[model samples]
Target: MQVSVKHSLPGRLRLLYDKNEYTSKQALLAQTLITVQEGILDTNCNTNIGSFLIYYDTHIVKENDVLNLFHALTGKYLEDPELLKNVDQIPETESIESVLIETLAIHYLKKWFLPLPVRTLLLWKSLLERCFHVLSKFAESKRLFSTELLDATAITVATLTGNKNTASQINLLLNIGEEIEEITKRNSYGNLAQSLLSADEPVQVVEGMDEKTVPASALKKDDVVVIRQSGLIPADGQILDGEGMVNQSSITGESIPIAKKAGDSVFAGTVLEEGEIYIKVVQTGKETKVQKIIDMIDNSQSLKAAAQQRSELIAEKVVPFNFLVTAATWFFTRNIVKTMATLMVDYSCAMKLSAPIAVLSAMKESATKGITVKGGKYLEEAALSKIVVLDKTGTLTYANPVLEKIYAMEGFTEDEVLTIAACLEEHYPHPLGRAVVRAASEKNLVHPENHTKVEYIVAHGIASTLNGKKVRIGSAHFIFEDEKIPCPESLAEIKKQSSLEGYSLLYLSHDGILVGVIAIGDPARPGTSEVIRELKNLGLEECIMITGDTEGAASKIAAECGIKKWISQALPEDKVKFIEDEKAKGHKVIMMGDGINDAPALSAATVGVAVEGCCSIAGETADIQLQKSGLDNLVTVRRLGMGLLEKINENNLTIVGVNSALMLLGIFGVISPQMAAILHNGTTVAISIRSMQPILK
Candidate 1:
């Protein structure tokens, strides 16, 4: 009953006499033992193989039963456990819940679980717990762990437990978890550690791909890798190829599955269900997605924040200098240990970790909400803006203005005007032509059945022939002066009104006579008013509209949107100057725009937010791009950015307060070096934890 790795005498005899030539069976037995030894295996690979071997060698699972489940999971090779290891972990393990949780925790929780410092601190605390667990499981005798390990683990574990229910609860739990709970309670590390521990299981927080992975050193032969739907495909191979749907949402952001066939490229860590894929290792397991994720987390500690770098430099200079003075104190008092304590307190981990982690966390937060802030610096700067300037066409209103109204001239019916208009505009591809064509369709007017040569007259309009009649659609200036068409009283009033309502007018003529007109306008989105109101409430100094349209049209649109000022008929160059003028007047302006014309203005503004579905040039020039072109994203950007600033400010205040008190104690020789190190590192860890708090709507 007491199974153990009893080597030497029985090993050769068992191998020779048993005649168990089945390599797969031996691999399974080896895998199960490894899992019991390691405490957890990937479970993705082992589950299928172990199940099959149990049924196969003993005839529990008939060949046909294996085929039925195998065919149901992967359409092919149900009898081959070697083939089952080939599918991505996520899709392969979607049917199993424990494997799903473990896979998610490995893929995302490890890579992007929390802010970097908070995650690092939590990881360290988790490491201590893991070490103890390892010792408890493997130790020959039940020797007690060191006080340092117990103290650190207990404090962090309690914080995690307390933080789960309430932040305040963490403080209450410290006394009961262990002897070191009191030590954690008196330090900042306890706060963040508790919060991380208290948080919902890391797997639950990981709703999407976060690139978590098993450590490279940990992957073993025949280890099962789990996959889930909506998970990233983490490995590359065709080991166990089962038929099932894979949600490639994590990798491609796609909603479809890749049908698993033999020799298909199976990515690591993808979620799988309704099919089973077992892979037998083509690529080395060390190069897996899980390994890469673990590698990134392990290496993240070396990625010094800007503040951390500065603190390190300060420590190098000041700590050495402080230690030199401590040497003199040691020389007088003959206490070497006391001098070592002075050196210990000089590390300043909290000051090093806080500010940068706050900034990075804010950037990560913005990305989650569909805004890609280019860098941490921009997030910091956006929080201080006072003015918001908007571009007229695509930013404030829809870029494709619809045909709002069509006015016919004397002797021309509205149908007559549209039929003729659609005919002439059919061959042209300008915004005006497209709008007119769309309107004609809505009115059930057939576009010209036949058309002649089409010509685009710059600064004028389009001209073409239909039914052997020369048709021209242009501005009134072109038609009246060149073609001698009269601009009637009705036509003049139509032009005036179009200009006042942000519409660009196009004139229609046939055989030297003005026949009709079409008025096109860029209408604001339905939710634009709410978005603008929210921005104003969030402390925007003023919202202004700038456009190349006529003053009347700009003013009218501005008034409707509740904007106070309008700059009309402004060219691209004028927009840049306007941004400079706003800055001169002491305003930090955020320009929201689209189109190539808005590029210069976008580049000039303090923060340029491009509405999604805009011109390629505008998207390229913008600092932030909305996923859906809407004013709602704009509101989200401002609110989330402000919340980020609040986090930074709070972290800064906490660091200052803790450091000041500690420094005050250090001057009095009351604070030991080890306590100082813990305090500094703990404070940094605490600030990182604070940054992870959810922002409000």
Candidate 2:
């Protein structure tokens, strides 16, 4: 249940085997072939190796005649006990294991040499003679004909003219070997063994604690823990109080100086670039967004689409096709040698080898580019999507509002109001808090140094003591009424202007006087309109806006982004329904958002795209996650998805189209089975190459 390889080898193996090609008849045929081969080789251990060695002077027996004689003796030895009894009736025998190994070696040689038509005919003719010569030396009834010699004889006669089946079989065998080798390299024993033997998932149990191993997960809420230079912040929390420069680059994308102090929230995974600070822990374990993202990615395989589903169906069909081809050939030719050649020419090998490999490789490449596709199905779905829906906040606007203007009440100046508010809010982490601080910094106002105990009201504002006066910075509702701060004429005018401009207002108060107000709002992302223009050029329709913001704000943002359709004041569920409704109308919509509120909608879309730095649920539910949380990723993903689809289409055309054509031509009497086999095999090589075309940059 843990999904670890060491913990679930049998389950993992079952999953892996189930994913490979399967058809009832093909399964039965492969099982039957393996069973028959194992039995025959076991019985012929004493006789076949001796016959096989007679043709070779050295230890290595490279001739095809010797290999065919070995297969004939082995097959006959197992099926006809009379032949074995006669061989025993002759004389002293050689070592059984050595002869058994040599017989296996001969089978291996036959499999190896059967696919090369240039040399196969010569080897086939020579091997048929050797097999007859060895059997002729025995009693008449005890003699068994070589299946290889018979099939080769059929090929020799059937290919009097230039037919394709003979060449096709040889080509199919060559392609199969190469495909199997490549697949083996990808799903290698080394990879499986390494995954199985990896160190156990780093557990945070106190039992595993040691001096050298500082258990970061041991941290708890509100606990002050010191971070060494370059060490990571073990958990999410605010600095109780410290003086240090920290690398906030991992979290805030700020590569420059970020001073740490009391009340500054520090997230886990952020390094202490220079000085150290003690921080409190807020969230951990599954509560952390990172863990949830991992869980989401692990579970994404179930959401496959039509393309992958069709490919799976095709693979399943190939198994039945393989068995039928082999059975039909066996019935007509009445030869085991001809049957395997038919089986060897199946397109299943290439189909099974390339389909998932191409998808997984693309996923890996996308991840390196900072995007994480949950599974192949989503990649397929994304490739076909036409409509893209975007969330206004965080997706197209800054997560934190930037300070644009300040309005003062009757007797207060903007600087006086902003300075007092910034001093009180300097220790807070909310977007509004940062906005006020930035405003003060821009004016070069020296924040009051002697600040007393500061405390925050969630979803509201900050309260602190400055110069022995109660200072409060928050929403209008929080600063008025009981506080008796009248709405002055100037302040009221600023509120009206901000509302029309789509800005949220933050009230600032000092010592019971309504000083002034700070205006904060989501600002248009830099170059956002240009990105939309590019998307339009790339065949994207008008961007649609979905948001929880006020109607005015939503409308403003939509216009800025060049979107014609917009929805406002909607909850998370509303967003999901909007996307579903579009889908119901036959629109293939790609929903884009980077918040927990967008998770459900993202999951509901034909394909969900999440930018990097989004909430865990958003990232997990999304079909495609961009590495950079920018519109640029949308362009990149679209191109990549299109390229992938084109490759798949090309493969389908080359492999399925060409092979079917050759088969029909052969069946109509214009070509032989040998020639058909050659053409069929060539199609597989072409398909694999076509499937591996690189995605556009």
User: What TM-score, to 2 decimals, does candidate 2 have?
Assistant: 0.56
Q: How do the residues 1-697 of candidate 1 rate in per-residue lDDT, one tens digit apiece? A: 0111222221110111111322433333332322222212122123222332212322233333323332343223223444334322211112223443554555355456666567556555654665676476437434332222323433344345433222112222221222122232222222221111100001111113443333222334444444433333334446354444553322321222344644555544345532445543334443353333233323334443334355444433443344454466567656433443343333333434444555455544555565665544455456678888887765676554568788887688888888877777766544566678888898898765676888866446677776777778877677888767777777667767876776767788876677888887766667777777888888877888887777776786787687888898888899999999988988788898766678888899988887754454565577776656677787777777777667655665675567656644544467654454456445555555565455644
Estimate, for each residue in 224-246, the C-alpha lDDT of model 2 and write its tens digit: 56665556565666776465555
Q: Score every model by TM-score.
A: 0.47, 0.56
**Alpha-carbon local distance difference test for all models:** 0.53, 0.57
Candidate 1 wrong stretches, greater than 4 Å: 1-348, 411-430, 433-490, 500-502, 507-515, 613-627, 656-683, 689-697
- Least well predicted 10-residue stretch by lDDT in candidate 2: 10-19
Alpha-carbon shift of residue 630 in model 1 (angstroms): 2.1
Quick one: best lDDT, which candidate?
2
